[model samples]
Target: MPLDLSRRSLFTGAAGLTVSGLAGAGLAGCSQTAPSGTTDAAFPPGAIDPHLLGPAEGVALLSRNENPYGPSQSALDMIEYAASKGAYYANQEAAVSLMSMIAEKNGVDPEQVVLTTGSGEVLSAIAVLYGPRGPIVAPRLFWDTTALYAANLGMAEIQRVPLTDEMEIDLAAIEAAVTPDTGLVQLCNPNNPTGLVSDPATFQAAVRRMAATTTVLVDEAYIELSDDPEANSCVPLISEGHDVIVTRTFSKIYGMAGIRLGYAIASAETAAAIRPVVMSWSPCTSYAAGIGCYNDDAFIDFSKSKVTEARDMVFATLDTLGLDYLPSQTNFVYFKSGLEANAVQAAMAERLISVRGQYMDYNEWTRVSMGKVEDVERFCRALPELIEA
Candidate 1:
């Protein structure tokens, strides 16, 4: 969908105008004072150190595919404003407005959009709702975390199709794997771990063919980072009234992973079915952040450029080391390490860097997400030594 210039201006203006007013509200009576004598001193002796819960300082965290620069200034401003109203439940009108904006941006009816805590909610909801109908068909190796969670609970059965020899998701194989009893078809474009994007035309055509038989869920979490997000998205299929559901997340592009906001576009009926199964509601702060940065093209461009720069560093290092890697269209690179995956992971950890070991049976391959430039530099520097060792 085309960017709404008027909306962009409004967002820019709001970010600039709200600071003093929000500060005044906090300075006045809005700020809450915590009760006295309620500090960490009251905690039990065995309580885990909060620091241990996250990455250690100076560690190059390249394991999780998160946008290193995110929640743009506009989002931060909006989040501040939203926090002042934290005592109250999120305004229903504002929630509706966000859905409307997303609907307008994606060229779908508001009824077709169901907002959730994150796209993970959409995946789990789909699994619970449709998994019992039959088996979920998906590529053998993709981001199957949520699907696997549902399967463990006995809510779904998944039928996996192996990737092509080139490590690309084989749409033909996935299509052939789907039968009359198939519950849903799950696809992650610019698929996770491999980072290979399917041709948009071919992808859409294949989805349409599969949607003819059963619902198809297209997880476009990283579509915005792909070469052509508009063409790569299967969202238009929903407008065409196919049994297709398109999921998107502000977590990846907007850098709002901790904030937890995502949504799905489907036929109004499908959306309705999915909404009931969503486990949690996003806060007003997250909604405000989404509204602020959803149209901030400049920030998106900046983030993508940084990701590209970091990815290039990894690529150049891999080239020098004679390592094989797939040409990536997303924010991470999957490469053949020529050593045991766990060994490489351990070696990187010993060097105070983090990278994924393997996925499924690709034991000699590793996936490293793009981190901050300096952090990626650390990974690149350590990789050569690890490989040589």
Candidate 2:
């Protein structure tokens, strides 16, 4: 259901990019955190896979940053209909339609977009196109999955720059690090592990500066959950004809991790460079569900409200327990565990809670994904016991 241009024209103010929020919510490939409710004996249509853990009750999986509320009713109904019809394979036309809407929202030509299994696949494709003994520049302590992808492909070295003391990405440092031989530069706005963002104007200037020497990858997997996803995004950079690629997912905000769908926006030339290398496909069911959710402002608003409630609960508990934490722009928060993070992790695991640790260089830093308010409360109840021991 591609929205008519007349209807699309209605999106102009705060809701301009809100229509596309359902498109790029994000997912970490493995279920480091299972779907919010781990107890039901019966698996739901898009239930969390048992990839990392067996199903059970009262398990709070705050490690994955997944949407606990799940896909909108409209999306769910579409998914159910697709599955009922046994559309086991993906449809090319469906992908075309989905990308058409995404392109319109980003103000780019449809040819400038490409679909991936998840945003993670787009990262891998970028690495595959430009790695295996190339200079990729990135933050020293940010998201590592893409770095790990390059490493596995034998990327010789990634020139790393440290973030500023205030926890924002050091755009100048990154620009300075770019060399004539640099293949790609990565900027994870509202960075992972730190949950902090850089100034958008400064970010765009850096992208323009670095684009001269190398391809820039702006991973905005968590951008939709930001206070103003539109202003913070890099799609505008793409619209202005920069060699930048912005990848996002439906796993986080849209609650479709199990369905596995995401896409990338780039200049037509950059898209052309990466298109042939990607599968050029998304599951038919995923496309249908995405269409159903694309403009569902009610569900998006409700989900954001839920995240706010849960995030506040987490912040309040962190303060009560005398923990120092970074202010967040997304659904999760990063805090100092004080004790051995692994020990805290194991302790919580025993209590049926899963969290994330082992970020770049901090032993005390822990990343906790926002769950339902009650789930965060359970984690808070378990925190004191976990850290004290």
For TM-score, the strongest prediction is 1
lDDT of each: 0.82, 0.75
Q: Write the per-residue lDDT of candidate 2 for residues 298-368, one digit (tens) a residue.
A: 88788888888888888888898899998898888989978777777777888888888666567887888
Best by lDDT: 1
After superposition, which runs of candidate 2 have C-alpha atoms over 4 Å from their true positions? 1-55, 387-389
TM-score of 2: 0.84
**lDDT for 53 (candidate 2):** 42
RMSD of each: 10.0, 8.4
Model 1 error, position 176 (Å): 1.0
Worst 10 residues of 1 by lDDT: 8-17
